[model samples]
Structures are given as C-alpha cells and as structure tokens.
Target: MVTGKMFDMTTPAALLADDTAYAEAVETAVKAAAAYYATGESALDDEAYDRLARAITAYEAEHPERVLPGSPSGKVAGGAAQGDVPHTVAMLSLDNVFSPEEFTTWAASVERRIGRPVAGWSVEPKLDGLAVAARYVDGRLARLITRGDGRAGEDVSHAIGTIVGLPEKLGEPATLEVRGEVLMTTDQFERANTVRTAHGGAPFVNPRNGAAGSLRAKDRPYTVEMTFFCYGALPLPDTAAELADALGESTHSEVLDRVAGLGVHTAADTAVPPRTASGAAEVLERVAEIAGLRAELPFGIDGVVIKADSAADQRDAGSGTRAPRWAIAFKLPAVEKVTTLVSVEWNVGRTGIIAPRAVLEPVRIDGSTVTYATLHNPADITGRDLRIGDHVMVYKAGDVIPRVEAPVAHLRTGAEQPIVFPEVCPQCGSEIDTSEQRWRCVRGRDCRVVASISYAVGRDQLDIEGLGTTRVVQLVDAGLAGDVADLFTLTREQLLSLDRMGETSTDNLLAAIDAAKRQPLARVLAALGVRGTGRSMSRRIARHFATMDRLRAADAAAIEQVEGIGTGKAPVIVEELAELAPLIDKLTVAGVNMTEPGATPPPAEGEEPAPSDAGGPLAGQTVVVTGAMTGSLEKLSRNQVNELVERAGGKSSSSVSKRTALVVAGEKAGSKRAKAEELGIPLMTPAEFAALVADFLDEE
Candidate 1:
C-alpha cells in the first residue's frame, strides 16, 4: 500500500496525524472515484485516483476493523446505477498494475495460488472506451447495456442498430452476452465535433468522453457514428482459456476469431501470438511490444491486459472480490501532468466563435512539451473552476490537441484569478453573442471579413494564389476589399499602394485574380463561405443545380434533395444563398464563371464531343508537394500546386506517407524531404514540377 498526504492534511508527515480526518478523507476519495468511474469524466486522472485508493488501502491494512464498507479498494469501480437496461451479469473493473515488476509480482502470486507454474499468457490492448455488454438471443441482437456500478447498467438497445462493427444478427443462433467497448475513431470524432460546432454545441473533450456522452444523448438524434470491439463474453468464463472453451474454440486467440465470425469486431491484429512463457521476463517482453505500438493504434489504449492462458490455472487461482486474480491490467504511464496555468487566451475563429485557449507553464507530456491547452468554451472553463496561476492537470486528448482537465484545487493560492469571458470581440469591438455554448461576434460578415476572405481564398475554394492571410488583412484594413467578390474589382494601382507591392508582385497578384474568374462553379460556391457548406457539399450542390442561377433559385426543399443537406441545414443554405446574391451578381458582372467548365450541353448528332483532360500526363499518381518553390511554381501557392495536381488527373496529398509515389521538394525543404529520402520516394524540384505540368498541358 502507498502513503500520501491526507485530503485535509497539508504535509505528507501529517497524513496519519488524525484518525477521524484520515477516515473522512478516505470516504471522500472513494465517493469521488465512484462518481468519476460511473460517469466516465473525472475531476482527477487515473494516477490521482490510484494514489487516493492506495492511501485508503494503507489505512485499512493498519486498522482493518475500520475499513469503509463502500471503499473503492473493496469493490469494483462504480458506474451508472441507472441506464437504458440492466446488464445480465456484473461487469467488474480490472485491477491495474503500473510497472512490469508489479505485474511480475502479481503473476507470481497467481502461480502460487494455483500451486503450479503458469503455461502462458494472452495480452491485448486495453482500449479507453465506454464498457458495454451486448446480448444476442436467437442469432439477433436483443439488448445493449452500459457497465454501470458492476451490477445494473443502462439499457442502450435503441443505439445497438446504429453501432458500427456490431452485427444486428449473428452468423449462428446462440444466446450469448458479448462484452466490449463502444468507441469513436479519431476521424469520426473530428467529423462529429465539426458538425456539433456548426450546430452550436461544444465539442467533446476526447473520443472516450464523446462516445459516452453521445451514447446517452437523450434529446438529440443518434447520428454520431460509434464502433464496438468485443473483448469478453457471458455465461461468465473464469479466464480467456475458459472463454475459448465456452465458445467451442481451442486457444484464447481462437475465441476472438469465433467472436469475429459472429460479426462482432475484435482487435485480433494486436492480440495475436498468444505466447507461452515459464518465466516473467518473456511475458514482460511481450507486454513491452504491445505498449510500444500504442501511439500508432487507431483508437486510444491506456494499458495492456495480460491474462493467464490456462483455464485450470485461472480456476485454481480463483477471483478477488472485485477483479479476477488470474488477470492484471498493466497500466501505461499517464500522458497527463500538473502544470501552472499562466493565463487564458481567447481566439476568434473564421465562424466568429471565440474559443478560449489555456497558456500553461511549459510541461512535457507524451514526448512533447505542451505550453498550451484548449479550455473549449467559457462554460467549460467555469465548470472546471480554472483560474490563472492555479496548478492544473493537463493532457493531450487523442494524442493530438492538449486539453486542461481540471485545476489542482489543493495547490491553489488566493492569487489565482477567475477567467472572465470578454463581452465584446477582441478584433473588432463587436458585441459578443453568448446564446450558444461558444460565444461569437454578433457583427458576422462586417467584422469577421478577414476570416471569411481567408477561407474563401483557401485551397479547397477559389484556389487564390497570392491572396494569403497577410494580404487579405492588408486589403480589408485599407477598405479595398469588403468581401470575396471585391477582390476581382481591385486595380493594379490599388494593389501597388500596399506595403511591399513591387512591380512583379503587383503583376502576379493581378494575374492570379484574373485566373480565379475561370474556376469551376463548385469551387466558386465553396469559395462563397456559406454556413455548413464545405468542399464536398458545394460540389454536390453544384452538380445537382448545374449553374449559379439554378442554385440561387433553389428553395429549402430543393436544397434538401442534395445528399448530406438535412432539414436543419437546408434552410440555412437557402438563406445564405439569398444573402449572397449581391456578391454573386458582383462576381458575375466581373466575368466570373457561373457554370462548371466541361459541363456544357452535349454536341449535336454527327458532331464529336471535345477532348477531355481526364487522362492527363500525371494521371493515377499520388504526389505530395512541400515547402516554398522557385521558378514558375514560385508564384503558385500551396493550394495552386494542389489544383495543378488535380487538373493533371493526379491526387495531391499533404503528407509524405507510404502511399505517396512522388514528392515535389523546393528550397528550404524540411522533414518531408528527409522522410521522402528515407522512404526512397521520387523527388522533384520546383522547376521539375513546372516542367511536369507543362508536359501534361502539352499532352492535352
């Protein structure tokens, strides 16, 4: 057992100073852990909870008679008592071992209990997701229940049908209760958050939290995609070996195969090579291999579960009051750490949403020095009770963006000040709108012109070459361009007046603006910066309506016919299109293309159709272009390079992965060049890229 400072005790030496105080602290810790485990979101991290649990265990060991009845040490971690339905069998939490030595010690204890050396062990990644028990009766999914309090769980049968990787009907008729994790992939999490942000809701902190919250969302429709991975089964097998036998399989690995055959998803790739080892060193090596691959895994994994592979050994080893004695979860070191909250910075996004970011006293976590973390919104900041100068717990959610979990209240001083959300926009002094969870500038287009224009000139939109953020800001500040359409009307003299606008630079800018007028209708629609309309949506809408006139004439019902344009978003699209009519008219008057090129009506009978650029020189290749280029490509922006790649019938990727067949590296080329060299991918200079495009055009 471990000893630490008591909850109310100021010093470690004073932990056992008062018996009553220690007892109260233990009780409080137990309650907090229970609540957190039940809800899947916690004020304290796993490490903190472990410390508190260890403290209570140490107290109980010294004074066994005074052990609290509801202590976390004596029972499985608590879960939601109420759910959609009750679990058929109790879903108990596993005992966690932090170190390989601790794991070895546990394995020895299991061997001692069984009165024999263990044959082998089965190891698998411990996914960080919501625990759910899915029951199948007569080859059909009957019910789904959340792991609530190791006893009764919530019924989520309604969401069972929507769950990916979970078959509604099994391959064969059988009454089996499959226990697994319900989780959202990284891409799914991002998409869900994007949609949620557009719909005026706060994005979930992490995928695990997102999955748990989305699964239990009562008010909203169940549109969020979630995946399930089966890890266990009922009739309550004593061990993985017994589970295999129960399923009429040979090895623990085979049990997973059988589960997959039943149309239930399992992490078989990671769970392979069930090795038999007489010594702890061999088992430790296997565990280490699994831990090393955690970063590359699609889903989040906090640890690895090592289970005794023999059914007899597990049976003889028996079970603890809470967890199985034959199995132990070797928890990975936490990616979170305590850091001082220096201050909070609010940033205005393209949509006018004011997002709060936490500036932290630099701390290293998961191989990266994290100096900043997202506070999400004002409500999240206040709810977490975060304040400047407070020591706070920070972690990288999904191993990507850093997030402030909560403030360390015990480490706080009176100097800590509350973060006040601003009443007005920092950029334009516009009144802030707090109607939604995320506060936004009320003066939408008038004040947020910089963001709108920047997005409009983005790679996926108009593919404007020289209209970068700095130029856009200068243009907006000088009142030369109020909207995206205004860019086309600027004269060479107006551009030359801006700072650093030389003769060649002015000419290049003019040429780029002139070229943007010929962009396809889909790109033009995307460039318009319509609410909830992205590249794909714009393409779909343009394809359906064919021309800008038809799209402008489209009502909500007609817009709703387009795929992904639901009832909620259709009206917004129609309203935004109507609002953008003036801008459209301005662009039309300036000779911007209203119809998609090459989409003209077919030629008359006896007349051959014009040749298409579908089979261009660079066709069927994946190219990744990086760094600033020289020569003809010098004036071409990153978006322009990508546009060139697309026009040549090749896909332009942002990263140089194994799928990248060619990499166009320019001056001051960085990591991408190094990676390409290492991978032996074909490399090209800016001049070479220009030549390649010229060749493609010559072929056309």
Candidate 2:
C-alpha cells in the first residue's frame, strides 16, 4: 500500500530554478501516479498531482539539457498499468485555453510562427472520456492500447468485442492505427449503476469514472456498454488536414466523415469549418455553440478542440515537447458545485407543465450565482433520491441552466426529507395531471397565459423591444390579453393604465408589437410554442412550406415528410395546428406576413437561368471573403461579410477549396489570398464587393 505524502509542495518557478529539486519532484509524482493508476487508490488528489507534473514541465522547459531521463513531463499522466504494450507514436496531451482571449492569443502565436494568417480551422467537441489507441493490421483489429504513458500503454484487446462503435474489421484491407476516446453514455452510465445497485454495489460517480472502471474490469459479464469516438490516427500525419489529404480526402471535415464510414462514432453536427482570415473568431463562436449544446448531447463534452485546417500551416507550426502548437483545447468553465438543497419548488410553464426545481443555498458556479436548479421531473427526483436538506451536486446543463445532478448521500444525517411532487398547480391550486412522470396542470391556458405571452415576445420569437415579462404580467393581470394573439388587440388606453406605462413607453410597445407582425413565418411558428418544435425545426417547417397557408393545410403525412420530423411527431404537429387555428386566424387578421422572408421561389417554366452567378449579384458562384474590409464594409462583422455574399446572389464559403469560384480579399488578407492566387481563382477587393452589392440592389 502507498503511504505518506504523494507529492512535494514546490512552486513551479522555484522548482525550475533548481535542477536537482525538480528531478526529485518529478520522480515522486511519477511513482505516486503509477501506483494510483495500478491500484485504484491515491494519496494525492488530481489537482495536487497536476501541479507537480506542471512544475516538472516548467523546469524541463527552462533547462532542457538538464531534464531527467525518466521524467514524468514526457509521459501521459495517470497512465500506469500492470503490463505495458508499446505505442506506435506517443499519445500527447493537449494545452488548454479557458477563455476566448487565451484561445485568440494562442492562434496569434501560431500565425506568428507560420509567418502568415491561418485560412481555415477545424473545431470539434472535446469528449470527457478515456483515451485509447486501436491498431488495425490488414483491416482487421490487431490491438487496442490505453494511453498509459505516451510510449507504452495497457493492452485492452480482450475487451474490444464489448466496446460499441468499434468494428473488429474495416470494410477495406489497410494497415492503420486509430486513436480515440472510450466513454459510457449518460444512459449507459445510469443503467450500469442500476445493475450495480441491485447487486449491492456502490454506484459509480460519473460517466468518465464509470467508463474507466468498466474497461479495466477483467471478469465475466464484460457487457458493460462502452462507446468509442475516433479523433486521431497514426502513421502520424503532421496534421488532420494532411491525414485527410493522404487518405484522398479534401478537408479535415472529410477526414471525420471517412472515420465514421470506417465504423467509428464521431459527434454529429459538431464539426464547424473555419471562417475569416484569423480563424480565431470563427473558432470561438463554434466553441460557444458547442457549450450551449453540451447538455443536450448524449455523451459529455468538457470543451472543444480547435486546430489549424491547412496541412502546410500545421507542419510549419510544429509541436511542443508534449502538445501540438497548431491545436488547443478551449475549455468551458467548471459548472459543478456542491450546494445545500434548502427546499423543492414546483414551477409552472406556459404549456402548464409543472416541473420541480431545487431551491438551493446560493452558490457561485461558472461565474454565476445559482440559487435554484432544475430537477427535470418527478421521475428524476425519485430515481436520484434527492431530498430537502441534502448536500447536492449542482451542475449547469449545457453551460446554461443550473441542474441538480445527484445528492451526496454520505452527507445525509437521516434528517433529510424525500421531495414530494405537488398534487396541485402552484399558480391556481388546480388538480395536477400526473399520468406521466412530468406533472401538468389541467387548467392549461387559463393558468399559463402570462407565460405564453412572455414567450411570444422573447428574443428567439417575436423579439418585441419594449414588451417584457413585467408588462406581459400587467397585461394578463388586467385582463387586457388572454393569449399571445390578444396582445396585438391591446389598446393604447389599456397600456397607459399599467403602473409604469407612459405616452412614450405605450407608443414604443405598440410600435414594437406592430413590427413583430412582419417577422418571418418561422419566427411566428416558434412564437406559437408548439409542443415539439423549436427555432431550428420551425425554420425547417417554414422553408418546406414557404407560406403559413401551406403549413396550415399540411396534414400529418405531409409534415412527416420533412427531415427530423418522424411519424410520432407528425400526428402531434397536425393536432397542435388544428388546436391553434383560431389563434392563427387572429394573427392573420392582424395583418401578419404569413410567408417566410428570403425564400427562393421555383424557376419559371421555359426560362433557363445562366449557370454561374445564379442567385443575386454573386449567384451560382461560391465566394470566399477574408480579412478586415474597407469603405462601408469596414465596420461590418465577419458574419455580415457572409450575409453580403449571400445577398449578392453568391454562395459564401469559409474555405478556398477547389469548388470556390471567387475570393473577396479584404485589408491585410493572408494565406487565403496566396491560395486564391495559386488556385487561379478570381480575387476581388472589398470596394469591388461593395460595388457588386450596390449594382445588385440597384437592379432589384
């Protein structure tokens, strides 16, 4: 058994100044780490071990010649196994960026090293799972190795059959090595815990811990479902872009596609192509999008990986002693915290769905003071055995809403009371419908009209500038509005009667309400708050039908024809539409547009349009706009550039691929400009783009 202090408490700077002290610290950290991984126990927590490792790394950096031979700085952390299998290539750890500024700084450093701006980048979700390297010989599974210590790892070939998304053989015969993450999904983690509990075993903490335990377990019933998502490969290509090209693929995005085709699972809709000359801004946006989607994903993601998309650029940037210089992990802020569960509150939504919320002692998480967290539903409460007065683990779902993950059962002193679901509506004291796990109020619109109206004016929907929750409540309480459509009917006198309303406020609110009528049909659909439809689904529906009249006339079968709308949702859509007909008619009578804006109509018969430049000024042609712009376009955002391209009847592309027809080079344009010149694609200045747009608008 390991005993005494696991790590030496030495400051990184101080340790770096002394070679002998740093070497001893590294030795202690490595031995302790190995013992912990091999025995499933540790004297030092992850943070302590990480600090020691970091010190070693800092010391090695300052005195590269004096670096110890068997230094832990050169090895993967927590990679200690009973037996070793040599890795074909070292499994390196990534350098991390916790904020947008850091990520931007890292990108700037890369550009400085490459002596040119990066044209494109690949952004992918960073999976919080165990790392594994799978080797295939003659297209058959030859070996599976853990990321034990960079050079060597534990052989887990015996557990290959039990792993999901990892095929024993490829479709074609080829010698390849695939490196990826092994993890258990949230569902699988829960199921495993359930089985373990039934057999009188303690539950696993989280999916990451559960995956590690299941993979290392050498026993019968090796059927604990695990999943693999491939991120890298060997023969060790300089970059993902190089790997793609070597495999006859066009871009890094195509590399992931090919990996998926080879029977490995990769996160869907998570790969974002780089836009803009610097690539930093586009990557940061992608990171934000991924963070927003974290809670909704089946598996867990702690951050996003951003990499330079050009093979030559990556080669020029090269690698550090451990991490690649071309790539960085942009991590989301920590969302988990232990907080006291003061009580449970049942909150009512616009749809009359009554959900349980945990009223907590105020705790700060991810820079926000979270006092209440979502309990999901009554079933979730019971399944997790959450109770009042219990110490609970609170985490932000998708880095957005705070949610109760689980209770710290060991902290319970038998004084905790089981949280009971409300039998009556909190708003109206009406009988609650508990037929499903999610309790709802039978009162429906009568009790939820305020919420419905508030949602209608929300930013994602109508975006009424002056219509806020307070005004919405006042309108509802005064009986001036009963539903969302009733807001349009509200008179100036009624608005003036509200506590805070004046002539200016009343006129602004009315004008905002009037402007909402001209919003796209998709926005109108989203404002209606259909049971299963969101902004994206509503957009799909609007694009499909083109007009509100067509959407209203669409039956269940017709609605189901749209992608993402399955058979189960189709009938619901039909039923909801029928129920909302009266409200739809009211909005139509209020002079709503009833049509999606910017939708392209079908071509006229006997008219053949020219092949290039099809849509607007840039129509039928793929155009790439890069760098900062001058003149009127100077102040426009990067997104505005793409918008201008699309508005000019041209397709806006992020990368200058072979498919590109035109390159709009702005002020200080970089590698993309060079690439455009090399590829013989027509290059235009920002002034030219502005002139082209002006010409198109003039013609219109």
lDDT of each: 0.73, 0.72
What would the TM-scores of all predictions be? Answer: 0.57, 0.59
Candidate with top TM-score is: 2
* lDDT per residue as tens, model 1, 1-700: 1111101111122244456866776666766665454544555566566666666677777888876666667676632244445555557778877666577688888888888888778777788888888877767888788877667777777786768878999888766778888988777877776666556665555666678777877677336888898876654333245443565434455566777887888876332223444567776665555554455456777777888776666667777667788888877655666778998898887767788999999986665689999888997776566788987777663256888866666556699988877878987898998986878788766667888899888877877888899999999999999988899999989999999999899999889888889888878988887877876567657656768987787789878888679998999898778867888999999999998643333333488965554576677788989878898777666755776776676777766667798999998665567557646799999888888788543322
| Model 2 quality (TM-score) | 0.59
- List model 2 lDDT by residue over 207-285, tens digit each: 6656777777787343578888887655433334444356543344555666667776666423222222246666665
Alpha-carbon RMSD, each predicted model: 9.8, 10.6
In candidate 1, stretches whose alpha carbon ends up further than 4 angstroms from where it belongs are: 1-31, 37-43, 51-93, 97-230, 234-250, 253-326, 330-348, 351-396, 399-443, 458-460, 463-468, 539-546, 598-700
**Cα-based lDDT at residue 488, candidate 1:** 91
